[model samples]
Target: MCRLLGVVTHAPTRLADTLTDLIEPFTGLSREHCDGWGVAAWQPDGELAVSKDVLPAHASPAFAATLAGSVTDAALLHLRMASPGLPTEPRNTHPFSAGALAFAHNGYFAPVEAIDELIDPDLLAGADGDTDSERYFLRVLTRLHDEDPVDALALAAADIRERAQFASLNCLLLTQDALYAYSEENPDSEVSRRRGPDFFRLRYQARAGRVVVASSGIGAQDGDGWSLLPYRQVLEIRRSDLRVSTHLVRGALVGAGG
Candidate 1:
C-alpha cells in the first residue's frame, strides 16, 4: 500500500505553498507506508522531472528538499509501503515514469506472472522493479498509445481484475497537461482487510482554479472542499482551464464503501 497526492494548477505554482502543509503530516503516515517516497513534477519545458528515495518520507531529507521546490503546472507524489516479499529500493519507488507519463499506485494485485503476460514484451522490458504497481503502470501506458487515458486505464483495470481475483487497483496517472485518477478495490479480499477500507478510498477537491486528488484526505480536514471520489470512477483534470471530467468504468460493487 501507499499514499498518493496529485495536483493540477491553472498556472505555475510553488509546490512549497500548495503542498508543504499537506505533505507535512503525510510524512507522519510513513509510520506505516514507510518503505520509500517519490515525487514527479512537470517542468516548464514540458518534461517530467522525478526524484525518489528509498527512505521513509518522514525521515528523508531528499523528500523534504524535493517538496520545497517549484513545479510548473502539475505534480505527483507517492509514499510507498512495500507489499509482502517486495524489496524496498529506489527502483521500486513510485511515480514511475516513461517518456511524458508518470504513475503511482496504492494497491496490490497478485500472481505477478499473469500481469506480466498481459504487458507487451517491449513495455515489460522497461520495468526497473518487480512490484506489481510498476507492471500496472506499464500496462496502462501501453494502452495510452491507442486509447484515451481514461479508457486506457479502464482497460488496464479490467484486465487486472480478470487475472487476479482479489486485488485493489487505485492509482494516479500524470501527463504534462492533465492528471488522471482511478479508485477500485475488492472489499472481500484479504488485502482490503489488512489495509483498512480508508486506505483504498480516494478523495478530491476542486477549488481556486486547482484540483487536488489523493488516496486519502491526510492533509485536508473532513469538510473544506473535499469530496470522496466514488469507487470504480475515473477522473480527468485538465490544467488549461481546470475542467474536470469524470466517468464510471465499472458498476459499483456491493459492500464497497469509503
Candidate 2:
C-alpha cells in the first residue's frame, strides 16, 4: 500500500505548509507505507523537478526540508511501501513524470503477466524499475498524448479496469494548465489490495486571485467547502475556477456505442 498528496494552485507556493507539515505525518498510520517518499512538480518553464529517495519520509532530513522549500503551481507526492520481493530502489518511487504530466499510484497490479499485452511497451521503455504502476502510467500517457486530459483519463480508467480486478487507481495528474485526479473503484476482493476511500474529494479556493486545489479538506474546523467527487467523476481546476462533470469510467470498454 502507498499514500498520495497533491496540490494545484493558481500561484506557485512552497509545499511545506500542506505536504511536509500536514500530509507526510499522516503516513505514519500505515506502517508498511513508510518505505520512501517522492514529489514531482511541473516547472513553469516546461520541465519537471522530482526528488525521490529510498528512505522513509519521517527519517529523511533532506526530504523534509526539500518539501518545505519546494515551490510549484501543480504537484504530486507519493509515499511507497515496496512489495516484499521487490527491490526498494529510487526508480520504484511514485510521482513518475513524463513530459508535462506527473503520475503516482497507491496499489499493486500483481500477476502482471496477465495484463502484459495491455500495457504499452514504451511505458516500460523509460521506466527506472519494474513496478506495475509505472507501466500503467506510461500506458495512459500513450492514449493521452494528443487527447483532452479529461477524456484521456476516463478512457485510461476503462482500460485499467480490465486486468486489475479493482486497481486502487487513485492517480494525480498535472498538465500544462490544470490539475486532475481519478480515484478508481478499489477491488478489495483481491488479497494483496489496499483499501481506498469511498469518496474522492478535492477543493479549489481563490487566494490572492490564484486558485489552489487539494485532495484533503482545508481548515481545522472543516469550515471549507470541499467538493466531493463521485467514484467516476472528473474535475479540472485552473486559475481558481473548477469545472466538474461525472463520466462513467469503469465500463468504458463494454458500453462503447451506447
Candidate 3:
C-alpha cells in the first residue's frame, strides 16, 4: 500500500510546511511512504499542476525542490511503494489529472484488461502510464468530467465494483469546485473498509482555515478534530463546511453540493 494526502482550502497556502515538509522526515504517518511522492496543485484559475516520480520523497532533490516552492489552494500527494511489475518510473507515479480535477489512489486492482474496459475511450489520452492507479483515475475522470459528473462517478464506481474484485478501492478526487473522498473496498466476496491498523485510518485535519486529508493519523494535535472518515460514503468538502452523503448518490443528485 501507499501513503496519500491532499489539501483543499479557501486560501493559497504553502504545501512545503504542512503536507510536504511535515511528511518528509521519518516521524509521521507519511514518513515511511517515501518510495514515490508527488503533488497536484490547482492554479489560480482552476488549472491543475501535478508532479510525481518513483523516487523516494526523502531523497529526490527534484521532488524536494518542487515541493519547496509548491503552493496551491487544492492539492494531492502520494508516496508509493511500487506493486510488483508496475514499474517505478515517473509516469507510474500518481495525482493523475484532467482539465481541473486531480485523482490518486492507495491500492492495486485485479486485472488490467477489465480495468481498461471501465474507462471512457476518448479520455484515455490523459493516461501517461500503465499503472492501474492512473487508469482508474482516467476512467473516473472521463465520467466525472463528462456533461454529467454525478452519473459519471456512479457509473465509474459501478464499473469498478463489477470488474476489480477482491481489491481495495480507496479514491481521492479533487475537482474545480470541491473535493470528494470515497472510502470503500470491493472484495471478491463482500466489500468493506477497516481502520486504525490495517486499512484506511487517514485523518482529516482542519486548522488555521485550512483542511487537509491524509492516508493516516499523524496525531499532531487533539483539538483539531482530525476526523477519520467513514467507509461507503462520499465526502464533499468545500472551503467552510464538509458534508457526507449516502451511497450510490443518484445521477440526478450527483452534482448537488454536499
Q: Which residue pairs overlap in candidate 1's backbone? A: none
Q: Model 3: which residue pairs collide?
A: 202-215
Q: Model 3, range 105-181, lDDT digits (tens) per residue?
A: 87777675566755577767556787877877777776655544444554565566666653555677877776767
- For each candidate, the alpha-carbon lDDT, in order, equals 0.82, 0.62, 0.63
**lDDT for model 3:** 0.63
**Comparing candidate 1 with candidate 2, which one achieves the higher TM-score?**
1
Against the hidden reference, what TM-scores do the models get? 0.92, 0.78, 0.79
Q: Model 1: which ten-residue window has the lowest total lDDT?
A: 249-258
Residue pairs with clashing backbones, model 2: 10-211
* Model 3 ranges with Cα > 4 A deviation: 18-21, 24-34, 145-151, 186-197, 220-224, 239-258
lDDT of 1 by residue, 1-258 (tens): 788988988887778777655776777888789999999898777778999998898888888878777566898889998989999988999989988889999888887665777777899987799888988898888777777888777778877887776457889999867899988888988878876777688888888867889877385535678778777778889978989888875433322111
Clashes of each: 0, 1, 1
lDDT of 2 by residue, 1-258 (tens): 576666665566777764444554444522556778888876566577888887887777767776777777677777787765777888878878877677887666665443456556766556677777776677678767655777666666666666555445567677776777765555454432333333223433434433334444223122353445555555666524434344555445342210
Ranking by lDDT: 1, 3, 2
